[model samples]
Structure formats: C-alpha cells, structure tokens
Target: MRKNTIRPTDIKLHQKSRVLEVAFEDGSRFSLPCEYLRVYSPSAEVRGHGPGQEVLQVGKENVNITNIEPVGTYAVCLHFDDGHSTGIYSWDWLYHLGTDFDELWAQYLERLEKAGHKRKPAPAAG
Candidate 1:
C-alpha cells in the first residue's frame, strides 16, 4: 500500500437512484452519479492515450451502472449500462473524484458547452 492512500470501507450501488455511494476509511463519503462516472471514465477509450487525446463523452445523461467488479485490492471496474466497462477505478482516483467532483463536473459541463452540446435535465425522482 502506498503512503496516504485512502481505501473505500464500503461501496453501495443505488440502482434506482443511479448513484454509487462510497465511504472511505478516512471518514469521507461520496455519492457519484453514473453519468458523471461514465463521462469521466479512466478507460483509454474515454481518457485516450495522452493528455490531448481525450475524447469528450456526450449523450450520457441517463447512463447507469449495471455492475461492479473488484479488480484485486487496488481497484474496481465499473460496468455501465451503456456497455462501457473498461475503466479501472483505483481507490486514490475514486477519492480524487469525490473530493474534486465539483470542479471536475464544472469543467465537464464547460467542455460540453464549448462543444455545442447541451445536457438534458436529470430525471425526477418518484
């Protein structure tokens, strides 16, 4: 284990709500939306091979996670309902996603706007 690495103590997938709730050993918890995870996937298909090669994800407003597979003790692979299952989300990366969600989401929205894409409104909870 690396120094200062935070590990998830519990992970819950709320299928109806379409969110992944993760609680860490450090007492931090995050509720990550499936669409957000899909768009920010660490897979080469989404993140690409290099910094400038990132392919912006679009039309993922209603995406959801269908399954979660453990990948050793270091990470977990998220299988999205849209058939995207290549991102290996590490503990550190998950923590980063949790802590930096606001900024990252803002950036994602900005990128979408710049690309002339408009996000659809979230579905109402019933």
Candidate 2:
C-alpha cells in the first residue's frame, strides 16, 4: 500500500465530546472517538510482541485522553485517562485510523462479540 504524503495541520481534543478532531494538510478531517483510539492503541501491551498475541481491550467506553505529547516531528504520544501512554501515534497511523474508522470499528466490535465481551454501559441520561 502507498502512504500519502499528507500530514496533520491541526489536532483538537474535545473533552466534552470525547473525540479528537484532526485536520490534515490535504483538507481531510476526522473525528475519532476516544474509545476507538484507546482500543486500537499500538502500544506493546495491547499489540503484544508478535502476531496472534494481541490483547483485547475491554471496559473503555468512557476512557478519555488526558494528554497528547509530541514525539519528535513524526508522532504523538497519547496519555489516556486509563493510564495508558505507551502508544506512539505516528502521523501516518493517525491518518489511517481516521480514514479507516468505520471498518476498523466494525471489526473491533466483532472481535468483542466473538470473545463474549461487551462495552461498559454509557452513563445514564439525565
């Protein structure tokens, strides 16, 4: 697959909405939910050391990003509220996640279902 030379022009964290809105240099923008980002983190703990050793993340429906630190000029280290901060989200990877949000989220849900795991309940409506 060919990676586009696109780069992020801006990133905004909406704490209230629980989403990260990213705008790319190529004019493409995406709103990625915090839950999605948490579950798909590329950290060693979640990805494990090799194929087939992937760990499934559960009970992260309300997880939030506590911080976003730049990793040099190529990536950003996300500090999730759940105390997860090992994943270095590169620009390319972020773009990929944004663009492929739908399919990837569907796959995640399927995996959760197959494993007999369900997301935690959302907070009650007022």
Candidate 3:
C-alpha cells in the first residue's frame, strides 16, 4: 500500500513521559516502546555518517519523547530528551516495525548482547 493509502486512525500522546501512540485502521496497533523509538531514531545522530556507522544508544531506558512532528502525510519526526531530533520516521518504515516487531526487537537484543552491552534498569544502589 502507499503512504497516504493508510491513514492513522488514532493518535495519542502520553505526555510527561514523551510517548506517541499511533494506531492504523488495519487493526495494527503500534505500542512502540519509548526506548525502542529513541534507539531506532532515523536521525543523523543515531544513523551516523554512513551505513554501519550507527552509534549504539545506551542508557536510554528512561529517555522520553519530548515532541513529535508530523512530516507531510507520510512520516513523523521524533524529538527526544537528549535533543537528538533529526530522523523522520516514514509511514512505510513504521509499518514494517509494527508488523515485524518481535523479530526486530530480538535482533536488537542480540546485537546488544554481542556488544557486551546490558540494558540494566540501573546500577545497584551502594
């Protein structure tokens, strides 16, 4: 389907925590975790200078969405707490993420493990 072909049926903002929930008419509900949104951001800060050069984002579990901007009728730009707002999430990309969520999330976790990175809640109190 085309970008404009599928319009978001519902949109909600979970303010104070910076989350934007978008639901399409196809019964596809995207609860997209906030951290996932930040890490997978399509901006230069995360996408890096070129392919395979993406800087792995860590310790963003508590990072929240600050703002969400609509890009025409095809995409949405996200603003994060770290001030890294540059990526525009196209509808097609968002759809893929919503559809293949499980697989993509697993891949992210695996990559983190391979990199010796841990998604710890926080360092144990002393």
Candidate 4:
C-alpha cells in the first residue's frame, strides 16, 4: 500500500474578506487571498502553454471568488467575479500554492514592478 498525500480537510470562502481558507490533513492551514489566487491561476490563460509565456495579471486586487465547484475528488474549479473560471486547482497544486505562498507572492509582485504596473491596495477585510 502507498502512503496517502496530504489533502484538504476543509475549505471556506470568506466573500467579505476575499480570502479562501484551506485546511489540510497535515495540520496546515492557509488563508489565501483572492487576488493572489487570481494572479497565480494555473490555467493556460494565465500560465500559458510553456515556460516564459506566463501572462501577468493586473488590476485584480479586488477580485473575489464567486463560486467553487468540485471537480472529481482531487480538484476544484474556482469561479471568479472577474469572469475567470478556467483554472482547475488540484489538491496537490493547492497544497503547493499554500506551502509556497510567500515566495510566489513576492515573485508576482516583482514581475508587476518590472512591468511598470502599480498594484492597488487590497480592500480592507470586513
């Protein structure tokens, strides 16, 4: 028998705060901002088909998740208020995003700065 991988035990969307809280079986929990998820979407529309083809997402500071649809037992499709719903976030990918949030977020900010895009401040949590 193979050892099982860490899987999300709970996922909650706080529309008011614009955050997705995910708790994994490994006792790790992440409160991921909607803006972060939108910019870091794994969809081909955002990630592109190959390396060095990533599209920089801007003006998404206030983007919020509109819906969460489960896909099979391993993934979910997040529908965003900005009409972006193509990204199918797998359990493994979501776990990776949670674990690597800090570095990935910094990289995204750096990319935005390099592109001369000034990101708006996130809305205050209510």
The prediction achieving the highest lDDT against the true structure is 1
**Residue-level lDDT tens digits of model 1 in 12-92:** 999888999999999999999999999999999999999899999999998999999999998999999899999999998
Backbone clashes in model 1, listed as residue pairs: none
Total backbone clashes of candidate 1, pairs 3 or more residues apart or in separate chains: 0
Candidate 1 vs candidate 4: the TM-score winner is 1
Clashes of 4: 0
Q: Write one digit per residue (lDDT tens) for candidate 2, span 1-126.
A: 226557799999998778999999989999999999998898889989999988999999989999999999888999999999999988888988999999999999999999999788867644
1 or 3, greater by lDDT = 1
Candidate 3 at residue 72, lDDT? 96
Query: Could you arrange the candidates by TM-score from highest to lowest?
Result: 1, 4, 2, 3
Model 2 quality (TM-score): 0.93
In angstroms, how far off is 55's CA in candidate 4? 0.4
| Model 3: colliding residue pairs | 42-87, 43-87
Candidate 4 stretches with Cα past 4 Å from truth are 1-4, 124-126
The TM-score that candidate 3 achieves is 0.81
Tens digit per residue, CA lDDT, model 3, 1-126: 354556677767675544567798787778787778788877778878898998888877767777888999878888877787888988776777677779978878888888899997833434
> What overall lDDT goes with each candidate model?
0.94, 0.90, 0.77, 0.92
Candidate 1: Cα lDDT at 33:
93
